[model samples]
Structure formats: structure tokens, C-alpha cells
Target: MTIFNGYEQSDREQKLNILNLPSLEAEAKKIIPTGGFGYISGGSEDEWTLHENTSAFNHIQIIPRALTNVDQPSTNTKVFGLNLKTPIMMAPAAAQGLAHSRGEKATAEGLAEVGGLMAQSTYSSTSIADTAAAGNGAPQFFQLYMSKDWEFNYSLLDEAVKAGAKGIILTVDATVDGYRESDIINNFQFPIPMANLAKFSEGDGKGKGIMEIYAAAAQKISPDDVRRIVKYTKLPVIVKGIESAEDALLAIGAGAEGIYVSNHGGRQLNGGPASIDVLHDVAKAVNHQVPVIFDSGVRRGSHVFKALASGADLVALARPIIYGLALGGAKGVSSVINHLNDELKIDMQLAGTKTIEDVKKAKILRK
Candidate 1:
């Protein structure tokens, strides 16, 4: 299907007026509670990495080509055995109830309708089963944080498979929660219980009961654990939170089908390099052995182009999805995806590239 399919003129007018990433974020801030906004928007410690993630893109310049036949540029590509309409997919962010009543379910529905993919978070307010059901046959992946209890981890993997998850994204960066000043100042507590973990509680189940399990899982994750997870699950394994070439190589060596370059969106490490800054190095190290997925600080279509030109096979959107979720639930989320898709196509046409493969060959200059 073409990018313009089902995008009406009214939708374009509405999006032009109030649906860009920054505007949507502003709208979300006005609607979401102070604590909720803080949890979704703020990063760890001083937020140096947070600012750098987007700013790092400015250091690179796209050198567009002129006089090329580019009537139709295809954003379509395949990853993790799923054919995606665009290279962009929604990154896994936890506790969507903080933004809206529908939480992850709404996000899943929006993405599915738009033919996008979502990686559901381990701390999601909605259960994997419900989120998968919401996808309505759209592709979905399960983001897992290793649990100290091997049995618990195995149980989660079993559940994901049963729920129809297409793949497993194992996050290794956040062994412990980051030091976010917003959460400290707002005294934020999750608005809803973690749906998956809540099912395991003995009585009066709540989010607090899952803390010990989460902590244990984080502390127990290791490089060797990657192999164990791959061995245990029939689903393809994609390792997320890899920032350096060394770690990227390690993940590929450990049998990862995909290497996701992220710094936990600057939410875990205060001094980490932007995901874009490290994308080329990690991608080079992986050497096309596995698909390299990138996240953190992607704000516009130009950023998406730069990532692909640099080395990322695909890109993921994080905070922006939450912003859309806050403002309009499924509709808001779909608007964000549609806007990005539109921008990506325009950017590709301007760059004289006509497909996802051509994006890799597009010329870029680091400033």
C-alpha cells in the first residue's frame, strides 16, 4: 500500500495545524498530570544524554542529490521476519496508563491500524495477551527484563509465545531504575499495576509487588544470559540497550538475531553517547550480521534519514508515542506515525532515494 492510502485532506490539515511531534508533546504536557508527564518526558540525573540524543543529529548534514528519477519512494522493509510498511516502529515504553486510560492497548491498536509494529514493555500496564490481541494480526515484540527467578523469566517467555509475540527484545542496559529528578520531585507512583506481574501476586495485587522481581531480574542479566534466553525461546531474539561496538559484537556473538542500539533513551545512563553517535560504530562491528535497530533522540524525518545513512537498519520512536497517547489515545498515536511516515517519504524524495535500500546509500556529511 502507498503512504497516501487512507490519508484524507482533512487529516493533513488537522495534522499540519496541531500534530507535529513538538506540538503534540506540548499538548500532552498540558493534559497529562505533572508526575505522569515527568515520568514520560524526563531522563536520568542531569539529563545531559537526553538533550544530546536529539542534538547529535544536528552534527550530521544530509547531502541531497539532484536530477534523479524518483516518482515513488518505498518506505517498506522487512525485519524480524515481519514486512513493515515503514522503517519506523514504536519503541517499548512502560506503564502507558500514565498517559491515558487505554495505555499500551491503545498504542497497539493505533499501530496495527497504521501497519506499524510495537515492542511492548515488560512494565506495561496492559498484559501481553491483551496487547497482542489489540494488534489484530499486526506484528508485535515482547521487551523482556531478565528476572532473578529463572522460573519467572521462563514463565514470561512462555506467556509471550502463547500471546503471539513475533520476537523477543531483551533489554540489558537498565539493571536498576535511573535517577530521574522528576520522579523524585513529583513523588510519582505508577497509576496502574503492571498487568503481567500483577497476575502473579498472592492477594490485593499491586505494582509494588513486582518491584522485587524487577530488581532481581535486572541484577541477574549477563552476556551469557543472552544465550540462555535464545536457547529457551523459539522466537527470534533481539538484544536492546547496546551502545558500544564491543557490546554490539558481544550480542551478535551470543546469537542475537537483531542488535538494538539504545542508551535507554538517556533514561538509564546520564553520561552515555547518543544512540545516533554510536550507530555507525555498532553497525560496522555487527557488519551486517544482524539487523541493527536504533532508538533514542529520533525526533524528525531527517533524523530517521541520517540514522539509515549512518548504519541503522530501522528506527524506533519512544517519547513521541507517549505524547500522542496522552493527547488522543489510539488516534493520537496513529497521527504521530502517519506524520513521521509522510516526512520520511518527503525526505527520501528530496534526497533522490526511492526505497529503504537506497537510504543506506544516501550521502551524508558529519559536521
Candidate 2:
């Protein structure tokens, strides 16, 4: 029997048969470089927001309906005009090579097998072309980091368009990198050379070229650059890290076709509202002009259902998927996704919903 088949096993046996995301995280903590695990798993000071991200969901419950036929509930949803087999999408994660040799390419391949959407990080270890090739021409979105030079930024946008990325996600919240204690203690810099950044810092003399340029541009550039990049890319622009309704409106006004409501998985602001807490406001702010994607505090199919019920059009997860990859590479990742999909199907059936559209139809009570 396959490892995932827990038919006659006890709950404890099933739990220990093979590690899930959390167990994999513990295993990864033991195997990966001290700094990398901390960077990926640790949140801001005290990790209060990080705790809040996950815990907040528990306060909101899913009121399952009774006395309804739920034998064959459908779990399909379309994002950016593409029909995805499930509503879950993979979030953009950088330095994946640090986690595994297959890196983003392996992730693309695994995600392709299940018809999942993969979002490529701007700080990816592999190039855009490599990821696209690995996805076998599957629809992927390019996540962009705002830079010091508009011309150079536009050039990257052109490359993404040429690479066949379905959309562009501008990470607006990370105007500056946060104080990540894990990276500080372990010294985890991106594994690959950012060729575009190298030339931009010709004479910083301190031998800190890329990080310096990154820090300087983060402080110097205005939102106008974000507008320009959106104008330049024909692909739909998705503005990520939008915490407030005002920023959501600003992002929409800047020509973003989608808004990803995230707190950088609580890797950034420590005292800010949880990603789940602020999602409803952001969705209400947009008034349906664009689809709202959510991240931060998602680990199970129940969490996916919670986000959809709260108003997220789609949901993505970073650390869990990373843990899945670290534990078993592509197979581990595929297992987690497939499990989540299965749970989602059962959850929908139990809730008396037969379609993705019906997911948003549930009546949720908020305090």
C-alpha cells in the first residue's frame, strides 16, 4: 500500500506513518543550514504576528450544513482566465536551492503534475526561463522586486513577458527587508548572483553591492516606479503585500489586475494585523475590481476553506510547501498538495457545497 493510504491505521499511526508539513519542518530544522531554516520558519520579533496568522483562523469556524447530497463535490476554480484544478496556488519563494537541489524547477514540475499554479520569486535561484521550461509551458506568474532603475526593471518585465508568465506580482510591502534574526545569526544571503543588481552597484567599495543597491532602492524609489512597471507589462499585474484598504485601492489604481493580501507571512511587520485578520477589509476595499489572493496562516484544506469564506479568491502557502520539499523533494510537495485537495473535496461535500462558487456561499459568523 502507498504511504498516504492510512485505511486501517489509528490516528496516531497515521500521524506518525510519515511526517506532514509540521513534522517535515522539524526534520528540516535538523537538516538545513541553521540560518536558512530560521529565515524560512522564524517570523519577526517574538513571532506574535506569525502566531496570530494561524491562530486567528481558529476563532472563525466553518458551519457545515447537514442533510444535503455531497457525494461528488467539485473543487475547480479559475484564476487569471486559466482554469485551475484547485483553488490553491504556490506562493513565490526565493533561494529554494538552499532547501533542495531541484529548486524551483522541481517545484514547477511537481505542481504541473497536479495542474497547480506556481508563482516564481524575483530572488529565485533559477532563471525565469528555467522555471518556465520545467513547468512544461504551464501558466506561471513572475513576482517582481522594485529596483533603482526603471529601464533595467522594464527589461526584466520584458523578459517575463517573453518567458510567457501569465501575470506580474509587484511585491510592494518589502520596500525594505525586515530584521530577520535567523539570517542575522546564520548569515543567509541569496545563493545566486543577481546579475541585474551587480552592474547597478559599480563602485560601492564596501564589497556589499547587491544588498546595498537593494537597501538604497528600497528607500529611494516611489510607487511611481510600480505604476511604470505595470504599464510596461502586458501581463496582468498582481500587487502583493497590500495590508491596508488604502494600499489596496492604490494598487488597483496603479493598474493591478489582482491584489495578494499578505504580511510576508509575518516575516515583515511584527505588530501588524494578521494576514487573515485584514483580508476582509482589503476585499471590501477593492469592491471586486480585481481578485484578491491570500497568504499567511494557511496549512490545511480547512484553512483554504476559511480564506475563501472570508473573501480570498485563492490561497497560497510558502513554509509548509518548503518543508514538504525538504522532507521528500517533489514527491513530498505533491503529496501535501494532493492531500490538501482531497481534504478540500471532502470539506466541500460535508459543507453541502458542490462547487467553488458555493464555497463563498457559506454563512460565516464573525466576532
Candidate 3:
């Protein structure tokens, strides 16, 4: 039985009380369909890599320094030229409508309240414009999926800029969808209709707008689309899903200002290296020319420290926030982030660091 098992969400405020990441997973599992649950919760075949993602953090230990006047520690981190209050940024999750009625709107608002950022997915249930509006133009970024059609691609970039997204994050990892057993078994399609496509095309059709554009472009359009989108918007571009130094180099060549070292939470491509494992190398390859961000298996403040030591300028968490949302919409989401923020501050103080930059200067061991 899971932590959320047999428990009921009593009220709005109570939702935020669900502090731990796994604490809310149970509620989400019970509320969503088997397929939907599987899509969001399950991992690739065998899920060994998923388990390893979290377990890998176990090998490293924080060597904290004591006896200094460490009072209020700053958990702030900057990404794509924006300063956020916490090292935690909201990961781009697709089909958020599957988790809550208000979906990304709730998420954006909650993040706005905390003065943080959420990397809005191109596949989000709410339109990017609408999600930004919900956040009232708070610090925000757009995650892009290169579609087959360049026109649709350009249109979406235009929309992101018009909607007040401060930057764009291009997802290059999902060239083809990964082998997610839950999505396959459940035959998962997004629970909500693709609501954001109407602005690009006027009818109900698969691959409309970005999807259609993505289909047409395939591998042939990737490089050009990257340049095109960058040319079209002054907003900084971050290339996410880069797994290697080579890809990182390519991202830089294409004028990307940042890269997210992620493997899609082990949801795609089982048996791949953990995000933390490759972080150091990726960061080195970029030679500090641009910032490197990471997601996957970051469950605690120490894990946040580990990623920073590994060279991530910012770290993001997905399932944890989604788990929080499942238990209670906006408030639950804030609870999870706040919990991390509290823990991070405590951890930094214990480590004798007063700011996030100090975290970078602290020593780390990979054993």
C-alpha cells in the first residue's frame, strides 16, 4: 500500500501539508485511470534505470562544514538569464490535464505565487498563452517539440513570444517516443483534446500545427528549425534532452543559451545513464559557455546539492510536483516546492554555505 492509500484529502490547505514527494503519489494513483496513472507514473521496461536514477544520488554524501554563522541560506538559481528564488524549477510535463482539472494553469499560478518558473510544455493542456496569462507573466519559459512542419513550428514560437514566455526550451530527446510500457499498455493518448492547436489550424486533426510541422520536418528540419526559432525570437533558447557532449556542442553551435541534461525521467529509453551521471561531463564540455540544467531522480535537498556539484545551474523535479498536484491541485504543488526550499536552506546552512553560489564552491565526493 502507498502513503496516500486510504487517506482522503480533507481540504484546500490540507493539500499543501502533503509535503513528501511519495506522500502524494498514492492519491494520484487512486484518482487517475490505470492508463493515465501508468503513463505518468510507470517507467520503461523493467524500470531498472528509473530506480537507478534515484539510487545514484545515494552514492554521494554532502561534506558539511559547521560552526559558521549560517542563518538564512539562499536557494536561488538563475536559468536562461532569469533569477528564480529556488534551485527548483518546474519541469515541462505534457498532458497535465490528466493530473488536474485546471492542469498547467494551476501549476503556473502556484509557481507565480512563489516567484519561480515553470517550463511550460508544448503539449500542455492549456495553451502556452493561457498558461502565461494564468501566471500573469511571471518568469516563464516554453519547451518546444520540433514538429514536421516548419510553418507550424514558427507559428508556435511566435505564440510563445506573444504570450510573454521569457525563453524557449527545445526538447531534442524525444525524436521518437520512448518505450513507455504504461503508455503502450494503456494505449495512452492525452486525456484532454489538444486545445492549443486551434490558433495554428482550424480543425480537429492529428499533427495539426506543431505536431504536423514536426511530422513534416522529421530529422531533415531539426537543425534549420533550431536556427529558425532562434532567429524568430529574442527570447533565450534552451536545448533540453541533450545526453552527450556532442549534442551539447551542437546546441551551442545553434545559438542555444542553455541545455537541460535529462533522459525524460527514465520514461523514455530505459537503461540509459542517469542525468546526474552525465552532468559533470556535459557541464565540462560546455566549458561554462552556457548553463546546464538537470531533471530526474532529484528527490531531496542533498540531491539538489549533488546536481549542483555535478554542474547543474538549475535542477527540476517532475513526478514530485505532479504527485503533489494529484493530492490537491495548486496548494499541493506549492507544498512540494516549499518543502524542498525549506530543506535546501537547512542543508545549505548545515553545510556552512550562505548562498547557492557557495554550493558550487563546496567540495563534493562521488562515492
User: 146-193, model 3: which lDDT tens digit per residue?
Assistant: 777667677788888888888899888777666677767777555354
TM-score of 2: 0.89
| Comparing 1 and 2 on TM-score, the stronger one | 1
Q: Give the residue spans of candidate 1 off by over 4 A.
A: 1-19, 209-214
Total colliding residue pairs, candidate 3: 10
Answer with 1 or 3, whichever has the higher lDDT: 1
The sequence of per-residue lDDT tens digits that candidate 1 reaches over residues 159-232 is 89998898899999888878999988988766567887876666777754334654566565667899998999
Worst 10 residues of 1 by lDDT: 1-10
Best by TM-score: 1
Q: What residue runs in model 2 are displaced by over 4 Å at the alpha carbon?
A: 1-19, 191-210, 220-223
In terms of lDDT, which candidate is strongest? 1
Model 1 C-alpha lDDT versus the unseen true structure: 0.83
Q: Which candidate order results from sorting by lDDT in descending order?
A: 1, 3, 2
Residue ranges of candidate 3 with Cα displaced over 4 Å: 1-14, 198-223
- Listed per model in order, the count of residue pairs whose N, CA or C atoms clash below 3 Å is 3, 0, 10
Error of 2 at 288 (Å): 1.7
State how far residue 184 of model 2 sits from its true place (Å). Answer: 1.6
lDDT of 2 at 16: 15
TM-score of each: 0.93, 0.89, 0.90
lDDT of each: 0.83, 0.75, 0.77
